[model samples]
Target chain A: AQSVTQLDSHVSVSEGTPVLLRCNYSSSYSPSLFWYVQHPNKGLQLLLKYTSAATLVKGINGFEAEFKKSETSFHLTKPSAHMSDAAEYFCVVSDRFSGYSTLTFGKGTMLLVSP
Target chain B: EPEVTQTPSHQVTQMGQEVILRCVPISNHLYFYWYRQILGQKVEFLVSFYNNEISEKSEIFDDQFSVERPDGSNFTLKIRSTKLEDSAMYFCASSGDYEQYFGPGTRLTVT
Candidate 1:
């Protein structure tokens, strides 16, 4: 079984400030992790993914995340926040050993970026 | 860029009526999935399909729900008898591996 936990339900930051959204996962086998963002009235969009290649993964819109096996974390970070960044973010996990078919999603974190 | 497409962006049906949602995944993708998000709630998986059969399904996908690849291109989800609680935003996704592409979504309202 694989599961993802998004530590915070909501995160608020001012424009130009650093942003962080924490996520932790548990899986029986090798895991594949992903970050998805959803804007108002829009479908979910992939931000970045960790397929056990590199620990640090860079994504679109100046966002990135680092996968830490020891800590069971895959925290998303951004150098600076933008008003357009306000949206819902989800952390997803899948079992690679199981052929990476099904995915389990976190409850999600609602980001509020203020200018 | 190739992307998933879903029909009936919004549908309104009476309680007990049946509804069918359609999706056309990326041309070459082999795996397809259906997920739903109730108003103000997290998205939940409903079912996944591949190779002309269902691969996995959640508890929410009971007898009332069914999926079919009826043709070479279109994938459809049929709800036998929808209730008020059935209202939600349905999203269709297709993936070959680690990353999946999603459709705009179908907003169903069971009144």
Candidate 2:
């Protein structure tokens, strides 16, 4: 089974400051990790993915995450937090099944940005 | 840039009613999936469809739940008899390789 745990339920940061959201996972097979963001009443948008290729993956809107196998962690970070960046962020883990893969999502960390 | 789309953004129904949620995945994508997030809960996988049939399903996808690619462009998830617990934000996602793109979810509210 593949599962992810988000370390924080809510993270508050000032605009232009750094942002960090932590996640950890466990999987029986090789895993693919992803960070998805959802704005209020909006769809889940892909921020970045870690598929065993590169340890540090950059995504849209100036967000990035690093896959650390030794720590079993994939934490999202951004140099500057924007008010528009406030959203619910989910850390997801996917493991290949018979012919496909399924996403196991974390409870989610709600990022609150203050101007 | 193509993206997934879903219909009936918000649906309210009474218990035992049947609900069919529709989705149109990104064109050229080969894999489709359904997931749900109840209020204040984590997203849970429901089922995945590939090659015109179901590839895998989670335990949450009981007999009451079914998925279909009824037409060439439309993928759907149907709940035969929805319980109160079935109320959630249902998201449809499609993937060409591994990274899946999601659609605006359908809020299924069963009263």
Candidate 3:
């Protein structure tokens, strides 16, 4: 079984400041990690993915995440937080070796940006 | 630049009524999936389809839920009888490879 846990429920940051959202996962097989963002009343948009190729992955809107196998973590980061960046972020995990391709999502971390 | 698209941005239905949420996934994609998120909850996978049939599904997708790709372009999710608890935002996603492209989602309000 695979599962994900978001470390923060809500994170508040000032505009132009750095931001971080942490996640951890547990899986029985090789795992694929992903980050998705959702605006108010909207569907999720894929931000980035880690499929064993690279530990550090960059995504759209100036967001990025690093997958650390030793730490069992995949934390999202951005150098500068924008007002438009305020949204709900989810950390998801799935196993490539498992027949069940469904994703297990973290509870989510709501980013709050202040100008 | 292609993305998944869903219809009826919002739908209001009575309890026990059937609801059909439609989607047109990115052309050339082989795998399709349906997911749902209740207010203030995590996104939950409902089903996954490939090769013109269901490849996998979550426990949440019970007898009341079914998916189909009846035509060449459109994919759909039909809830045989929606309950008030079924109200949520339903998203359709498709993947040609591993990265799934998601739709804007359809908000279903079961009253």
User: Among all windows of ten consecutive residues in candidate 2 chain B, which has the lowest summed lDDT?
Assistant: B93-102
- The residue-by-residue lDDT of candidate 2 on B12-109, one tens digit each, is 99999999999999989899999999999999989999999898898999999999998889999999999999999999999886688999999999
Best by TM-score: 2
Residue-by-residue lDDT tens digits, candidate 2, A1-115: 7789999999999999999999999998878888999999889999998887889999999999999898999999999999999999999998862225788999999999999
Say which prediction, candidate 2 or candidate 3, comes out ahead on TM-score: 2
Off by over 4 Å in 2: A97-99
Q: Write the per-residue lDDT of candidate 3 for residues B1-111, one digit (tens) a residue.
A: 898899999999999999999999989988899999898888899999998899989999999999999997899999999999999999999887667878999999999
Interface RMSD, all models, one decimal each? 2.3, 2.7, 3.1
Candidate 3 chain A worst ten-residue window by lDDT: A95-104
lDDT of 1 by residue, A27-113 (tens): 998898999998977788999999888899999999999999999999999999999999999999878633327778898999998
- Would you estimate the TM-scores of all the predictions? 0.95, 0.96, 0.95
| Fnat: each model in turn | 0.34, 0.66, 0.57
Candidate 1 colliding pairs: none
Residue pairs with colliding backbones in model 2 are: none
Q: Candidates ranked by DockQ, best first?
A: 2, 1, 3
Alpha-carbon shift of residue B83 in model 1 (angstroms): 1.6
- For candidate 2, the TM-score of chain A alone versus the native chain A is 0.95
